[model samples]
Target: MKKYGFGVDIGGTTCKIGLFETTGDLAEKWEIPTDTSEEGKNILSDIAASLRGKMAERNIGKDEVEGIGIGLPGPVQPDGSVLLCVNLGWKEKNIPKEMGDLMDGIQVKAENDANVAALGEMWQGGGKGCKSIVMVTLGTGVGGGIIVDGKIVSGAHGAGGEIGHITVNPHESVPCNCGRKGCLEQYCSATGIARLAQEALAQDHEVSVLDKAAGISAKTVFDAYKEQDKLAGQIVEKFARILGKGLSNIACVADPEVFVIGGGVSKAGEVLIQAVNQYYREAAFPSCVHTRFALASLGNDAGMYGCVKLVLE
Candidate 1:
């Protein structure tokens, strides 16, 4: 068996790379600026060069390495082809073939960034010790990854875990970035939460601290909620209701053993978890009602760990 591998998570700003032992330990990690110039043509070559340098510095042979696993911020088909990654300026391409060729016969696997993060959490973070798990990332937008029996259910079209796009409201006039209306992302994401706060404050002259705040943000809302401010509590409850219901809907389909919440919004801590869980319980199927909820522990590194797991798998 190969003793080492590389995990690469490509983002619009930076590409995070990790060297890992097959035993699941990350031995080294680093980052490189994403050169998205010329439609991201330099991105793969840059990663290949960096990996070669690392291997040479460590006196490691290709035979000693398992392969490279990459998580891209886009939809990755089951065959390791990426349809498009707008952030990376990537069009349709086979990532595995491209990266593998540049890496001199080493194997390569590719997956969507969110799914890989879920895999990472299940393997070594919040969902560790669980065979089935759902990971929800509440960042600028909401992202999700579903894992069943230790493998990602990436779906036939690579859209398996797009939980954020689920329609939560039919009357919403504002369309989502996906050109859809009333997506869960419009209610549960950090930006969405802030937007909600703004709308709530606008609807009525609510006597709340948020009105006097210089800026409104998801963090501000959570902070205000912590202070037991009434208006903030209302906004948070609305956010929690939508998120919890969205998760319950996911549970009905995937029936995962655990739900791992991560991303910027999750930093709100136990309060967020408890609030979401309360709604999840109320909405979840009886059999799934007891599914555990956990905050993601790996943070940004979750993708890297998950990439390694992909190669190891």
Candidate 2:
């Protein structure tokens, strides 16, 4: 008989699940559509149902699994209740209890999605063999996770790694969902990159591919950059500059050995990483030059692998 562990990443639009063997290998992966009706309670129930369906399809008994780990989009309390998830439509819910009930007595653990991704990188991805690491995810919104001494370092209230919410421009505030202004996320995420490109085009009115797109997106900008579009190059460079500043701020405090850049935008590869690395080195404090920047080894599955780690390690 083979032993297995389950990893689930619950996002606003889809839920990703993976089964891992005891040997730290991914055995199977699956996904289900997320239904956020009722502010996420529906999504939670859907996840429970989907888990059972997957287990049945795989012919696996619940007892054969050691535990289940979940990576969520909101702040998860140390006790496993989801404190708040504006993106997921959850507010003050006992996720562990709810999911555990659906599991019928299985061990279930939850952590913020970004934190889970950080743990995944630390356990099996880019941060392997390193005890301290920082992971920055540049997606629709910027997210981050900090790991120190092989454990997630979520400060009191589980807000320690909310790096995106950090204020970049104290004076020139841009509205944030958290009721703040000039947050790093507003300036560095994929959305931010698109916004920057839009602003550039708005000011210049140049003849660029991005200017013609009905919907401007980070991917469009990146593709434009690859084709040597000067405007797109400018957008990418601006992203690097802002991202580097954010990393520098984080480095000054956490001083991690490596910074793992993840999310869809990271697919831009060396072009993006090199640009950010240049800025990070330039802006970082002189003593903070020891940090190495790497792309996330695990892609979308990082959250699932992270969830598995949440249970085992």
Candidate 3:
């Protein structure tokens, strides 16, 4: 293996760049703003310039570097071509070719941002020492990455791990951002949890702490649940049931060794794991019922780690 590599994780607002030892230790990290202006035409150029500057500053030659791995916030084909990336305003872009060319023919690999995060977790975080894991990210919306046999299952069309859009309530009227109704995101995401709280509050029920809370969020509900608030308990029960069932279905398909939970709502800590696990255990297939559940430990850096691992492979 080469002595060093670079991991570039591109987001809508910023691109996180990390210089790393091939042994998996991060050497240095920095960020560059993503210039989405002009349809993001300058995004790659800016990243390339920053990378070159870093190399010069460290006095490192390209010969000592393994490659650069990029995590993009959109579907990535097996050949590293992206048809569309609304977040980056990219269309018909071939990431490896473009970035590799910019870097003087150095090796480059790219994958969906969520997929890389899952790979990162599998490599050095929650799922470390495991060969397979399903990472569920419960932020404003639900996002997921599936790693099986130590590789990302991006699937045909690069949409394999989109667990959030899975329809949990087919008969519901509300549509997801993807324009489907009753997606798992509708009830299992942070926004979903808060929405559930709002629906509960609109009804006649027992006096609860949430009634007087400044704002209702997943944290508020979990906090109330910790305090044994009956209404919060009900809301949490519903949220957990839906998420657990969703994961149970995933287990039947992917049969990963573990489910690594991450993103904003996962901040609830052990309470979130226990709550979801309780229902997952009840509904999971017999053989998959024992699949482990753990919180994601890497937080924001997971994508960069995964990107770096991409080239290591």
Candidate 4:
């Protein structure tokens, strides 16, 4: 095995790069803007250039490095072909081939960004010490990654672990970004929480502190809930109920040992976890009721760590 490897997380705006020992210690990390102009023609070249410069500066020989493991913002086949990445202006392309050609003698592996994040958590973050885990990321939209026996289940068509798209409210009138209605994302994401708060505030003229605020956000709702605001408490309960039920559904299928929650909304801390756990326990099947819950520890570095994990695997 090589002594070191590179973990590259390609996001829509910036690509986060990390150097790591094959044993999983991150030696260095950095980021560079993702130039999406010209249909992202220069993105790969830019990454290759930056990596070459870094290697030269460190006097690191190519033989000492395992390979570059990358996380893409879209579905990726085992062969490292990306089906599409709207955010990066990418279409069907073989990532490993192109990247390997750019960096002679260096190998490349790629996986979906969300799945890589789950692997990252499983390796050294919230899911550490566990062989199976389901990670739910509650950002603008909910994202999920499933890991079992320390391996990612990318699924056929590379759409496995799309937990957010699960239908939680089949009756919802508005369509989701995926052109479907009632996805779990519509009710459990950060934007979903804010939307719930807005709907709640508009449905009733009840006296509340939220009405005086400039805007309603997930943080605003959580802060109010923490302060013991009655309306906020109700809103949080609803959010927790929906999220917990969604997690319960996932548990029924994946049966992971732990459910790691991450993303911006997780900053609400244990209160959020406790609330969600409470609902999860109530809804989970008896056989899975004891499933543990945890907050993701790696934060934004998770994807990069998972990227390295791919090469190590």
lDDT of 2 by residue, 1-313 (tens): 2388889998889999898986679998989988887776678777778778878988989888878899888778888886678888888888778788889877889998889999999888988878899999888898889999888988897887889898887885468777899888887888888889888988865588887888888888888999988898888888888889889989999999999989888988878889899999999999886589998999988889889887886
Question: Mind giving the per-residue lDDT tens digits that candidate 3 earns over 198-248?
Answer: 999999989999999999999999999999999999999999999999999
Candidate closest to the true structure, highest TM-score = 3
TM-score of each: 0.96, 0.87, 0.97, 0.97
TM-score-superior candidate, 1 or 3: 3
Clashes of 3: 0
The better candidate by TM-score, 2 or 3, is: 3
The digit string of per-residue lDDT tens for model 4 on 32-69 reads 99998988889999999998888899999889889999
Arranged by lDDT, best first: 3, 1, 4, 2
lDDT of 1 by residue, 202-312 (tens): 987558999999999999999999999999999999999999998898888899999999999999999999999999999999999999999999999999999989988
Candidate-wise lDDT, in order: 0.94, 0.86, 0.94, 0.93
- Summed over model 4, clashes come to 0
As for candidate 2, its clashing pairs are 174-182
Ranking under TM-score, best-scoring first? 3, 4, 1, 2
